[model samples]
Target: MQLFYTPDITDSPIYYLSEEESKHCIRVLRLELADHVQLIDGRGGLYEAEIVDAHPKKVALKLLTRELEYAKRNHYLHIAVAPTKNIERLEWFLEKATEIGIDEITLINCQRSERKEAKAERLNKIITAAIKQSLKAYHPKLNDITPLQKLIAQPFDGQKFIAHCEPGDKQDLSKTLKPNSRYLILIGPEGDFTPKEIEDALQNGFEPITLGNSRLRTETAALEACFEINFLNR
Candidate 1:
C-alpha cells in the first residue's frame, strides 16, 4: 500500500488533496471508488480512508479510521553534521538516513566545513521521498543550516556525542549508546573538528565518540552514526 504524508488531518470529512497526488491517483494509479489508501501526518497520525470519488484534479476519500502512533522506543536519535562539499553526498546521506530512521537532522557549519549554505527545500523533498520509499509514516525534522557553535548550545536532555577521528579517549558510538535513550551525535567537517571546537563540545557536556578505527567522509560518518543509534535501539 502506498502512503502519502499529509500534516493536516481534518475531521469534517473533507481533505484538499494536492493536484499532483490527485493526478497520480486518478490518472496513474486509476484508483476506483471505495478503493482504500493510507495517509500519514509526520507527527504520528495515520488515517485509513476509502475513496469516495476519483476526479482528475480532486480525489476524495472517506475517513474509515485514524490511528495515533505511540513512540516505538523511549529514545530519539538526532544527528548533526556538516554538509559535504559535494551536494550529492549530502543528499545521499539525507535519503538513507531517513530510510534507516532518524528523529532529527541539523546541518552544522564548522570551521573546516567546506560547505556553509545548505538548502532546506531540496532536502525536504529528498526526505519526503525517503519516508515513502522506506514505508515509514514519521518524517524526521530538518533544521536550517546552522553554525556549529550555535547548534552546540541547543538543549539536548539525553546522551550527547561528538564523532571525531582525532586520537584521544573516545568511546565507540555503538558501545556507548543506551537502548531507548535520546541521543545527539555531532559530526565534523572533512578536515575534522578543530581542537578548540572539540574542547568546546566537551565543555558543553558532549562526549567524544569514534565511529570506527577507519576514517570516513563527513556524510559517511554521519550515516554510520545514524545506523549505530538505530542498531543499538533494535
Candidate 2:
C-alpha cells in the first residue's frame, strides 16, 4: 500500500493531499473514488482511508480508522557527531540512521572538525522522508551544530558517552548500555578529536567508550553507535 502523509485526519473524508502526492494518487496510481489507501502524518498516528475524490490536480481521502505504532527497542539513541567534509555521505548517514531508528541527533564542533556547520533545512527534509519510509511515529530531533565543550556542559539525564579515538578508554558501547535506557553517544570528525577535547568530555562526566574493532568514518562511527544502542531490539 502506498503511504500518504497528512498531519490531521480527525475522522474526515475528502482530505486534501499535497501537490506531489495528489499527482501520484490520481495520475500515477489511477486510484478511483472509494479506493483504499494508508496515510501517516509523520507523527505517531496512522490512518486507514479510501479515496473520496481523485482529481488529477487534487486527491482526497476519507479516514476509516487510525492507530499508533511504537518502536520495540528498549533504549532511545541520540547519535552526536561532527559534520563530515564529504556532505553527501553525511546526508546518507542521516537518512539511513533515521530509517533504522534513532531518538535524537546532534552535530558537534570538535577542535579537529573539518566542518562546523550543519544545514538544518536539508537534514530536516532527509529526516521527514526517513520517518515516512520507516513508518515511524516521532521524527528524530536534529540539533544545531554546537561546540564540543558547550554540549558537554548541558544537562543530559541518560547514559552519556563520548566516542573519541584516543587510546586507553575502556567501556564498550555494546556492553555498557542498559536496556530501555536513554543513551547519547558523541563521535568526532575525520582528523579525530584532540586530547584536550577528550579530556574535557571526561571531566564533564562523559564516559569514554568504543563502538567496535575496526576503525570507521565519522558518520559510520556515529551510526555504529546508533546500531549498538538499538541492538537490544534487533
Candidate 3:
C-alpha cells in the first residue's frame, strides 16, 4: 500500500492533496480518477480516499473512511541529544529514530558540543519521509535546537535519564527502563558531557544511565538508546 503524508487532513468528506503530493500521485505514479489511495495525517489519523479528479497540480479526493489513533503505541519516548559535528550523522539518526518509532526529538546544545546548530528544515523533511516510508500514522515531533540547561529545567512526568561517559555511578539504560512508560533520555556529544553538566543533570532528578560497556559515538549512542527503549517495550 502506498501511504502519503498529509498533515493537514481533516474530517471533511472531500480533501485535496497538496501540489507536491498531487504531482507525485498524478504524474509520477500515474494514478487516475477513481484510483484508491491511503493517507496519514501524521497525528494518528488514517484515511482511505478515492481520487475524484486527477489534476496534476491539485488532485481532489473523496474520503471513504477515517480511523483515528491507528496503530498507536503504548509508550512515549523523547530523545534530546547533542547534534554531531557532521550534519549527515545527525540526519541519519533522525531517519532511523523515526522509523524505529520515536515520539519526539530535540537537538540539544552542550558545553562540549562541536556543532552548536542544525538545519531544522532539512531534518524535518527527513523525518516526514521516514514516517511515510514506515507506514506510521503518528508523526514524531522535531523540536528546535535547545540549550541543555533549558531542557533540563522543563517539566516532564516520565523517567528522565542522562547517558554520559563520566566515571560515576550509572545504571544500564536497558535494565533501568520501565516498560510501557513515558521516557526522556539525554545523549551527550562526541566529547561527552562535562563534569559540571553531568552534575547538573543529576541534581535535576535525571538519573545517570550507561548504554553499554563499549563507548559509542554521539549519534550511535543516541540510536542505541532509541532501539533499546523500543526493544524493551516490545
Candidate 4:
C-alpha cells in the first residue's frame, strides 16, 4: 500500500492534499481519480481514502475509513544524545531511530560536543520521510538543541539512564531495560560525557548504564539504545 503523510488530516470526509503531496500523488505516483490510498496523521490516525480529483496542485480525496492508534507501540522511548560532529550522522540517527520506533528525541549539547547546533526543519523532514517509508502511524517528537544539564534536570516517570564509558559501576542497558514502560536515556558525544556531566546526570536521578563493552560512536550508540528498547518491548 502506498502511504502518504497528512499530519493535518481531520475527521472531515473531504480532504485536500498539500501542494507538495498533491504533485507526488498525481504526477510522480500517477495515481488518478478513484485511486485508493492510505494517509497517516502522525498522531496514531490512519485513514483510507479515494482520490476525487487528480490535480497535481491540489488533489482532493474523499475519506472512506479512519483508524486511531494504528500500530501504536506499547512503550515510549525518549533519547537525549549529544549531536555528532557531522550533522549527517545525527540526521542518520534520526532516520533510523524513527524507523526503529522512538517516541521522542533531543539533540543535546555536551561540554565536549563538536557540533553544538542542528537544523530542526531538515531533521524533521527526514523523520517524516522515515515514518512514511516505515508505514508508522505516530511521529517522534524532535526537540531543539538542548544543554545536557538542562535535560538531566527534567523529571521523567519511567526509567532514566545515562550511557557513557566513564569509569564507574554501571548496569548493562539490554538487561537493565524493562518492557512496556517510558524511558529517557542520555548518550554522550564523540568524546563521551565528561566526568562532571556524568556526575551531574547521576545526581539528577539518571542511572549509569553501559550499552556494551565494545565502544560505539555517538550515533551508533544512540541507535543501539533505540534498538535495545524497542527489542525489549517486542
Give me the runs in candidate 3 sitting further than 4 Å from their true place: none
Q: Candidate 4 on 4-99: residue-level lDDT in tens?
A: 999988888999999999998988898988999999999999999999998999999999999999999999999998888888899899999999
Candidates arranged by TM-score, highest first:
4, 3, 1, 2
Cα lDDT for residue 105, candidate 2: 87
Tens-digit lDDT string for candidate 2 (1-234): 777767655655557887788898888887888888878775567777888788777787777887775444566788888999998878989998998888788899888888878789998889888878888766788999988899989988888898877789569866776777888788999988898988888888889998777888998988887776667546
Deviation in angstroms for 113 in model 4? 0.5
When superposed on Cα atoms, how far off is each prediction in RMSD? 1.5, 2.0, 1.0, 0.9
Q: What is the lDDT of residue 28 in candidate 4?
A: 89
Expressed as tens digits, the lDDT of each residue in 1-234 for candidate 1 is 657777766775767568788888878887888788888778767788888878879888788888776334456889999999999999999999999889899999899989989789999999998987876668899998888888888788899999887779998866677788889999998999999999999998999988887889999999998888888778
Report, for every candidate in turn, its global Cα lDDT versus the true structure: 0.85, 0.81, 0.92, 0.92
TM-score of each: 0.95, 0.90, 0.97, 0.98
Worst lDDT run of 10 residues, candidate 2, spans 5-14
Considering only N, C-alpha and C atoms within 3 Å, which residue pairs clash in candidate 4?
A: none
